[model samples]
Target: MSAIARSTEPRLDSVTCASPAGLHRMAYWEWGDPDNDRVLLCVHGLTRTGRDFDLLAQALQGDYRVVCPDVVGRGRSDWLIDPAGYVVPQYVADMVALIARLAPARLDWVGTSMGGLIGLGLAGAALVSPALRPSRGRWGLDATPDVPLGRMVFNDIGPALDLDGLSRIGSYVGQDIRFASFQQAVDYVHAVSQGFGPHDDAGWAALTEHVFHEQDGQWVKHYDLRIAQPFALQTPDATTAAEALLWRAWDHLPMPALVLRGAQSDILSAETAQQMVSRNANARCVEFLGVGHAPTLRSEDQIEAVRRFLLTA
Candidate 1:
């Protein structure tokens, strides 16, 4: 189950997972001493790939082995034929498969948005999902057992949905439009993510590389547009159903959790973030004043917060 990946970063190895159906490859970045038993798994938000944690990974150094995966349909991973297949169930399954491949024995998780939801669903469901019941590669659902998830971090997302933001995002879903230039695409990304704080040219450039596409004479996005189908499908009656589906997953999460909210984020509203803090007793909460949707874990302040939590909590 070792995932195969190649990177310029030092002191880590890459591996790929053989997964279900059309899902073939899972690309991830690893850092720190491979023999170190402590592992940290960082999953990025939707529309983002695993490499987003490059800075956060570097800061942590040898404290723990950090493994970041590009969920199916994003980054170097394969796309699903059925857009609806991008649901949480499939994602949770992908993570389980990833854990099997890594075989860290015990691991902590840090997930943004969709990645957070997947972790929450796995930790809170108490094995509610049939796909997560296996222990040591064998079925053991209904038989309570120790889980691999240790410290969990959820960034700029909660059980509550920012309907307006959700709808606004849905408006552009499934459109396979390509930009004439990478600059244009990056500009669009910056405009859309303005709530996440002010980024200098270099910061924006790094973020741009994670998602933009430049092919021959054209520039486009790297991930499939179909990844938006679920959000698009949530309309009229489906919206309520969609909200309920998400709420259940968040409410049921049962592990040590930490939630990071961007101060200006419309997505993970302040009130909702408070509710998340209240909901999970053992869960610690923090807010980044100048950011929204998510706090870029690279900043010095963010690095300290994450490192403090990783080492002490």
Candidate 2:
């Protein structure tokens, strides 16, 4: 892979993450002086890559060491051999390995949408996976607490899902096509993310980067089309069954929590985010205006809020 400096200042690292299934090489962008003991691992969302954090990481570099991992199916990380393996349990396994390799001890976490769910699944003191403890397949680990996942930031997703909104996402989950130009990609992004609402030109441009890949002299999305397969399993019956288990895990989380919801999010309702706060004494929440489903932490206010949440209260 041709290595280019991830940022204008030219500081990045090509890191490798080894998991039992395979030696999955992950390209991570690291910032900060490298001597800082405080580490924050940032995880990106489904159909998105870790590069999503470039702006936020750049801003937080001086205060905390940041490591961003492109989840298995999305970016530099190797696609899983089995599409069935793309579920949360498998993701949790890869994360445990990553924490062991990068943060052997406690550390901070920042996640966006799907990444946030992964972090909450791991660090939530009471969070449990039915698959993990079932007699059948369980994260491929028969035991629990594989690693210490510290404080977490859950972006929008939660235990209960809005079926209508979820199905809305499924409408274009795996359409096979390509855009003619970068601006076309940007327009498509805005169209799909109507829920996110009112981003400036730069914010819109940054979001476009999340799904970028170059092919045949054109820029397209990087993820495999099959990622939509999981959404099929999100059948009404299955989501109802799965959501309860997630809530149970939340009920038992042993660490501090921060839940941020887009004010207009259809997925994680305002009611549920508040319930999460009520459950944990240390848990707090903030909603970004004119946003739905997620708050991309690109705005100065968004960045400052996260910094304050992590470093202070």
Candidate 3:
């Protein structure tokens, strides 16, 4: 099959990862040549599955081996026994294991929302000495060479987040709601995902497909409800400290970085995007008008923006 055709036919696979509680399996979808060492890892937003990057992956599969992972507690991945394990540090550890399994000579990342934070955690570690890197004692991975993170794309995310946007996200997460039918599920997803910008009926349906699954004759969200526990327990002080660390991480990145933000994004403000470019010489910013919070790569212009950068970078 052609590369574009093969992109639609992703090879489903899983990687074994560990956490403070125990070992769990994380699911991932692979596209393009399996033997290719130039790897592109595309991660989705919180509560969204790896399938969110289906379009973007399909477009770039020919140029790179695209791997999209469903972070722990979401999609086909195993849920953590301890909800606190749902944090970014744990997710970073899990990605470390996945990276070891792939052992890419060069790696590129495209992360949306929560995925961006995970990328920061891993990318930031590259600046640390190999001996000080995450070891088996931390999450069952040996201290290997620093990650080969190359060009990166942060999809509508940054170190400093707007409180109002954070509040909007927290308000809907972890709700125990079920839909009567597939149509009902689609309607609900569109209602809450307006920040993803405009899309046609099919577009919305594709976005909804992996987010909700049928269980006990009802369509419920695919993610574990407990994933929201950390957000609930996080204190304002903790959030502030975390932001400081994230900014440090942002400053440490030495690779070419692209920040794709919605012009009216509540999550990544205009000021923050500007600051990101100003703080890092290797970073640049691009905004999509009429969009808010995020510009889903499903759209042609958005996908092209990422494609052009990765190709030239």
Candidate 4:
């Protein structure tokens, strides 16, 4: 892919939203025309920030208003008062408030990992009638008119996640680590994020720049360590229950969906991707070879796949 022009900087914005524990401000990076009605919401993966989508957003901004949010407890967003509030339900609630703020006539979603689960929840909620919605009050979403997801790009996630991948991720997700210098931080990021596939020095450096912040003359990861509480506390029964709910949500998504998986991904396996397409006629699947866990949408091939899916009539 071509390098993102230095002039195509995103505007930073935030909105106040209610979580089960309390209220917090969710920060988002907006690209292109704010007045543009075609809003595309791009959410990041676990421990990642909205800046993760910088390349993708820059590529598509001319065609749509791209909104990338730093999900609560990560990036510039506020950390939750309670660690338990880091689950999907709370994330979904915050997103509902964000959608309300955007008030777009048309909306599309691009979600990576945890973000995909949120998209599934939003799309599922839009499809289910209020009467049939579970007691969580439509996944804690307010009674707003249906704002269906026009289309979605689910990057390296699905209802059935590989336990091995989950374990590998949990092993390091919330660890508190510090670096004495920017180079040290970048090196650390590269060590932990090898699953993001092969990227040259420049690509890896770009990724590291967004994930680490300088604090007290030292560099540290951007997210709160407590963001891993939910993962740490999950029981096998809870996992089974969550998986069932996710499948139900996946089944309810009526919009056309694109499932992008890393060929070597331990999370969303090839079998799971096939199952997703089989269950939902509108779903299509694509795989990127030589990648694992996730494909950073920064590459030319990856961006092209997403652009064609989202821009197609």
Candidate 5:
């Protein structure tokens, strides 16, 4: 229901993979049974880490093995030597490596913001002609027969994004910010993340806890600042091209999908959510009132929606 009790902590782990530049390690946090065949992979938004799903993972750990990975440049993952490699293609490659390691019979995905784009790529590629699918050997894994997505949840993201919203996000994503104290860091998180809707003191604290680390005696956000470079270089034409590709991906998805949109969201507009469902008969959308860019699945209501959707047969 509400946030998970603080007593239950996730198991932290990492996996080695390669990028265009060289090899790097991607860290992940796991909850639930390691041997469980059902796997749920939760990926965080830009500038956020995998630990963001702590509460959601806690709620579903009993029935499924919930794994959340910090996308390459964020959290415990090693930053790439070439910042230019910080694109969705690289993120997707790393995730494929992760899936190979887990080797689940069935896989489901929950992706937020940039993470959602990766899910779209995986699900779309799995459904399309084999030639379009990302090469398994590219990531150093043998071609395991297509691991069908059991279900997918795209949190406040869709094929089409609002450029204004993206610009606003870009303003803060990779800033060189430092905090004098933990409380100060929490305050900064709250300020930038007000769109996540309201949270009690403890809930807010829990959300902020894993996002910062002590560096040179100062508290700094955990992600590599270079992660923002590619984002900063986006051109209007590039965005248009990407949107066309995403729409193609959305139309080709074969598995059931749930789209959660914040009622006040600027990132994932209501118009795009409507288009998503219209294009794919298996897709459905739910809007959370009073929330903005995204819904942090920390509340009882938010958690229940995801739990029911994920557990459905």
Candidate 6:
């Protein structure tokens, strides 16, 4: 390949979504045929943008109508009025709105890190009893019933998370920092994302381009710093409760699920990856030997794994 960044382009668009605080616009990059009924929704991790999926999107655009979204508070999306709304439930709600707009005859999901958690929430919500379902008003949709996912690819994430990894992430996520030049910004990304495995200069540049934008003669991180507030406020008890709920959700899912783990990932432990597969009859696990925390899905092997599962499995 000439370079990872050189590929078919995508159309940028936005959908109106609602949260308890008010309405916000969630931006997404659309690839492939807009009218194609086979939809693949790709969601990025905690601080990454929708552009993170550019390579993967380009690879599979012809096979599926790939839609990658910049979850609220990140990328081109609008920031939430209430920082607390940065949680998974809110992300899931926004995704529902996006799904409604697409109205796909078939839908699949590929989520990395935080994105995986949001996918889990959606999968779980589909199995909830009618009485337990959230009101449509809460999701900002007048009629968004729980739509079943055809297949789900959980990229470097699982129901239970490593606290140490979370601590490491929190240490720098919302830091107030600016870069003097593009190379400086790229260097900062490399320092923080050593877990993404190996990539060349062009690969690193592709990752940094959408994450930082020039403002007032300085390069600043594109996401809202306030997005970290909820993470900092999380307590052990809350985390335990959330994990239990996620496990409950994971066990109840009926759709085929693919769990991708970075062998060295601190966030998704090997034990949890195995548990994820064992708990669900339709779930399976795959690990990338040298990767950690998450896989960018840009490499040939990573992309092929996802393609085979989503297209054939």
Q: Candidate 3 — number of clashing residue pairs? A: 1
Q: Candidate 1, 181: how far from true, in Å? A: 3.4
Q: Per-residue alpha-carbon lDDT of model 6 for 174-244, expressed as tens digits?
A: 99889889999999999999999999999999999999999988899999999899999999999999999
TM-score of each: 0.86, 0.84, 0.94, 0.93, 0.93, 0.93
Instruction: TM-score winner between 2 and 5, please give it.
Output: 5
What tens-digit string does per-residue lDDT give for candidate 2 at 179-271? 888888888888898877788877788788658766898886777767888867777788777777777677776666678788999888989
- Compared with the true structure, model 2 gives a TM-score of 0.84
Q: Please, what are the lDDT tens digits per residue for candidate 4 over residues 151-192?
A: 899999999989999999999998889999989988987887
Write the number of the candidate with greater lDDT, choosing between 1 and 6.
Answer: 6
Which candidate number would show the highest lDDT if scored against the true structure? 6
lDDT of 5 by residue, 46-132 (tens): 988899898899888887789999999888999999999989878887887898778677788899888899999776665544533
lDDT of 1 by residue, 163-251 (tens): 87676566665677678877888787787777668889888878878777788777777788888877666666765675577666666
Look at candidate 2 and give me any clashing residue pairs.
125-253, 125-254, 126-252, 126-253, 265-293
Residue range with the least summed lDDT across 10 consecutive positions in model 2:
131-140
Error of 5 at 271 (Å): 0.6
* lDDT at residue 25 of model 5 (Cα atoms): 99
- Estimate the TM-score for candidate 5: 0.93
lDDT, candidate 4, at 116: 95
How high is the lDDT of residue 238 in model 2? 82
lDDT of each: 0.72, 0.70, 0.87, 0.86, 0.85, 0.88
Clash count, one per candidate: 8, 5, 1, 1, 0, 1
Q: How many steric overlaps does candidate 5 have?
A: 0
Structure candidate 3, residue pairs in collision = 265-293
Weakest 10 consecutive residues of candidate 5 by summed lDDT: 132-141
Cα lDDT for residue 259, model 5? 96
> Which of candidates 3 and 6 is the stronger one according to TM-score?
3
